[model samples]
Target chain A: MAESDPHPQSSPVEPVSPPAPATAPVDAEWHRMSPRFVFVGTLRQLRGLVIPAAIILITGNVGRGGSELILIGIAVVFTVLAALGSLIEWWNFRYALTDRELVVRSGIVQRQERVVPYGRIQAINVSEAPLERVAGIVRVTVETAAGGTADIDIRAIAQDKAPQLREALAAARAQARQADNGIAEDATGAASTVATETPSATTGGELLRRLSTPELLALGATSGRVGPMAAVVGATLQFGAEIMPESWWDRIPWQQAEALQSVGVVASLLFVIAALTWLLAIGSTALAFGGFELRRDGDHLLLQHGLLDRKRRTIPVARIQAIVVGEQLLRQPFRRADIRFESAGGEAEGAAGDSGVLFPFLPRAEVRALLGQAAPEFATDPTVPMSTRLPRRSLRRYVFGATVGWVVFVGIAAAVLGLWLHRWVDVVTWQQVLLLLMATPLFAWLGWARWRDGGWVVENGTLLLRWRSVSRQTLITRASRIQRREMTADPLQRRVSLASVQLSVASGLVGGHYGLAHADRHDTERLLAMLGGPRHEVVIHKVPATVEPS
Target chain B: MATNTFDAGEAGTSRVIEVPERLPDPLHQLDPRARQLWRLGSAISGAMFVGIVALGTFGAARFLPDFEMRWAWLASGITLALAILNAWLSPNLRYRYWRYDIRPDEADLQHGWFTRTRQLVPMARIQHVDTRRGPLDRRFGLASVVLYTAAGPAYIPALANEVAADVRDRIATFANIHDDL
Candidate 1:
């Protein structure tokens, strides 16, 4: 059993030699799991895979008896198998850290085993949830120095035994650390002195800091996703009625004013549907934005909330790859924002669809403070005023987009109206064409607004790109963290000697094209050179060890 | 003066150094029973693949949809040909490419055929090292050594005995020495 198992304390301990280190050993505590952990973890795991599979199977055979029966049988088999697997996992899973080695044993029939020497243990993380809090249990996750997918997770371990496990792990870690630093083997004399005074506990008030009604409202307002989802739903519901056979398509007449009067009934029904859709969308938005909070715990940050399936994630500050600050136009008034961290092997569904993320939301101030504590030099000081805004060259692209949009709108309208009315020649009246001609300027205005907000900066080995429509987002990342960088100029942009830059990082993409219109080629070249330099120049200093007081 | 970048062109000049005493691949010292088990598993897997292909080809002729039969045949034939070619060529290729050499500062690996690859992994860059044995490796008294860097991973196959310990110690030494750096 892995030490992360709920019953890790019960596992047999193995003895091994400690590697010598240069530094005096610090008392360290690794972690063990709580016994109840198996129950909760197995339940969560069951929901994650089986629920969706069951839903898909049931939906796929909604009306069929034979197929539905087969799917149900499969679902039942899976559930039974998963339950049996969990029982075996709970019974068989074991982990423990002795002075010498960290041993993990799992699997039912296969009886898999992993034994990591104390010298090879790298990082250890401990996490707890509200449920775990009530039960006095915590999860201990250990990362071995060995690469590959061989992480040890001990679920549902007793809270009391956690310190013992932590001490063992920490002792090993300290030994490893000392060895890395070239300290002597007998250096553990100072181990007791390095013991942490602070307990692994969160005070009640600290928990309250995560959410208040007003903050949740602000989070809702700043949440950029809600309005877009609402608009899509409303639009779909309104158009959905028209696609049905009951819409009475034959009553509409293009030639006479009486056609408008005849379609009034359908129009009213569409309006009512739209209103209902708007209400439902608002409800969904609230549900998504409800009960949000962010807090810090020791060297880790704890983010916990959920309208359903309450989740608590504790991430070590060092593991954070990058921080992104986003603002939607509606949230601009309050300077409300969402901050997400890029993490490795993220569990969220959206990451699989788009990119990996650790946390999806946080206040702007909290984000800065967190970054300042972790990789302080990497986060561009938020107080710094953006030196450059949109350039005049952006107007060209805006004009281009606006022109294309107007042409497409007019073309579609002409084709639909001409075909339906049987009057191809006179389908577009002079007034409609004039309206389209006028809309080009309106679109240009909107486009100009979008471009004006875009800006970029390279500071302290960190790259910052802030862009928005009505809302704005500032993305900050370490240069060493960047996985890929590309600069490209379109044909027209090339003619104008303007280019855009994209930086890809482990978390995802930080992208914005600076339209360097009036700047000389030399200026663009200098900027690119700086952007492409080694990572140290961006963030000069690592984050301070302690969190700053607000 | 600092050593110039490693040059394969100066192969003659690249003096042979004694192999590390605690190398990572010395697993052949393990009892013979383990080795036989490893080889047996590999043979079983290869036989299973052959059996599956034969059965699939014969069954596919009767069960495949008319439209898909052509594509199936083409794919199956290609797969079979590749499998057979691999079975024929793998031993020679493995023997030709297999080598582990340690310089004073770094480890060097030479492998691959059509596109020969030579890797010079600086001791400083390695995050960790691992030695592993599969069922097949157990049978042949062979083991594979893997070196991991923050950037990526490299694998060495069919190492001789007594290499695993040496590689692991050297890696641990390097990791410890350069951790902060």
Candidate 2:
């Protein structure tokens, strides 16, 4: 990908402003991104193709049949096109730091040009992959208020340049803010000229206080089915292979067998590998993001994470749509907690922002403290913890309904499987049928556990609602962010004076929900008041001065 | 010193706001692109029909059942021709009608070389503004000013570089003046 010059819309010769002075501090406006940025980005993009290419090659070989020559030629063409595309994409990608903006120009045919004016850029994130670390290159991604979709990555820059660029962007943003605050006449020229050099705020060593290897191992071990599931499947497949005749293996060709291996040996091996791999991945990820801390960098919260990706997310404090604090039964044993915030950006797994796992595991106390510190306004009354509400008698109905469904499913499966085996081998007996019948109680018990955990609590402006099954999710969001609210009561619930209230938020980030079912009218009213539901009447509750973390 | 710059500019203020070409509302502004897409789609469909005819009339007559691969060249030529036509016609037709006007407090963008659109974005609503010049823009010394708000970013394309700079500064000035409101 050849770098399309900064702005194809205007000429380079057009006078915008004079270049920065040589004496400009190292911590100045924007550090010119490395020339090798395209090379590194191209490499990163190509890395993703490796897995897909392997899949296509395997599939093509299997489907080739008698036309092996044609298949081989097609594969060669595919490889060549992919390789050429990687090169074209690499050549087309270019990033630069002008006095006014951080510019990224990329694309093969229809070029996309992203301009992050220093003032509007909220975050500068530098992430180092294991391979990049070896290459002494890090990816510095720039995030702006525009959204995460256009976040620009200046790839393969020197490790040293990451901090410098981050600082430069920060200072540039600060200058923009200064301009906005009426400190400067020309928001443009004056921002470029205001000279100040401050060393980038170094991430303190306190972040290293994250979980130990044992703690991480314990977390991964607790309630993780992938490992045990793999072990069981592996044992089953091994048993099957042992029982199957050699003729069965001979009848299936090698290509056919290899394709099936993913569901067979590979699937089983994944679990075995996942058990240890998850432990290590979690530990390393925690270490990298441990002591995860956030601070106000101008109007944005500057976040630094990673032992490897070493990413920084500059999220505008105001763009935060909602906040969620999650804890699982497994994490309960260790008293570890996961805290995530939903921000207006692109989607990511495990968190709201495009960056995954904002703060994966922290102590319950730490979660509150961090939320309070990071977003003080939204985290009003940090001392006041949320009140808990558990589902009442009506929960029994929900549980019973769930059991009936589960039993019906299992009953159908057992009847069909048992009938099929009866003619050929010994079918499942009455004892097996009785055991299957017992599954209703099992499902009911699980549902009851979930109902027992579900509740809603209003903490000043923030609403904390907890929902749980095997996996637990607790969401805490601001009252104003709720875009819409719905109150529903079933015939059973109405008889028992129970209602379920749901709140919708703008955008899909913190789903438009937090259903509080079968609570007291006073409790429901309290929720309605917090949501500013139809009545607009709220009974403010006063709490004791003494504070505690639950 | 900062106050001095504002004080100096106040004395030379021009009240007669120049209403240049206006850009339509966000949905309307995309009209040109939408029309182009419709045209391109129809063209491709028409080409497909023509391809069938050529294959039957000429391809079967010449290449016959053996050298039928020759149709690939015809398809590639048609596709490339369409692509070149799209690049040339789309931007040229769109900007020809997109009208913009910058006032002291807000920007009124009216556009639609074909389907008319009008949008009024208050200066205060602009969270930030970005000015960019592409290769084509550079040749004409034209630039694009993108005004970003909480909803999304809107573009004012094909302004002269100096004019773009001036408009950006003016918008920034308005944003500051009305920020409290």
Task: Kindly list the per-residue Cα lDDT of model 2 for residues A282-333, writing each as its tens digit.
Answer: 5554555544555565445666755556666655555566666667677776
Residue-pair clash count for candidate 2 = 32
Q: Write the per-residue lDDT of candidate 1 for residues A263-361, one digit (tens) a residue.
A: 686698667755555555545545754565556665555665667656555554544555667665665555555665654322211121112233344
Instruction: Name the 10 consecutive residues with the lowest summed lDDT in model 1 chain A.
Output: A535-544
DockQ of 1: 0.06
Error of 1 at A496 (Å): 22
The lDDT of each candidate is 0.50, 0.54
iRMS, model 2 (angstroms): 22.2
iRMSD per model? 19.1, 22.2
Chain A TM-score of each model, in the order shown? 0.48, 0.47
- Best by the TM-score measure: 1
lDDT of 2 by residue, B1-181 (tens): 0000111233114354322222122211221232334355456665776567555656664756664555656665676576657655655555444655454445556555443343445554454566665544554445567766433556776555555665565555554331211
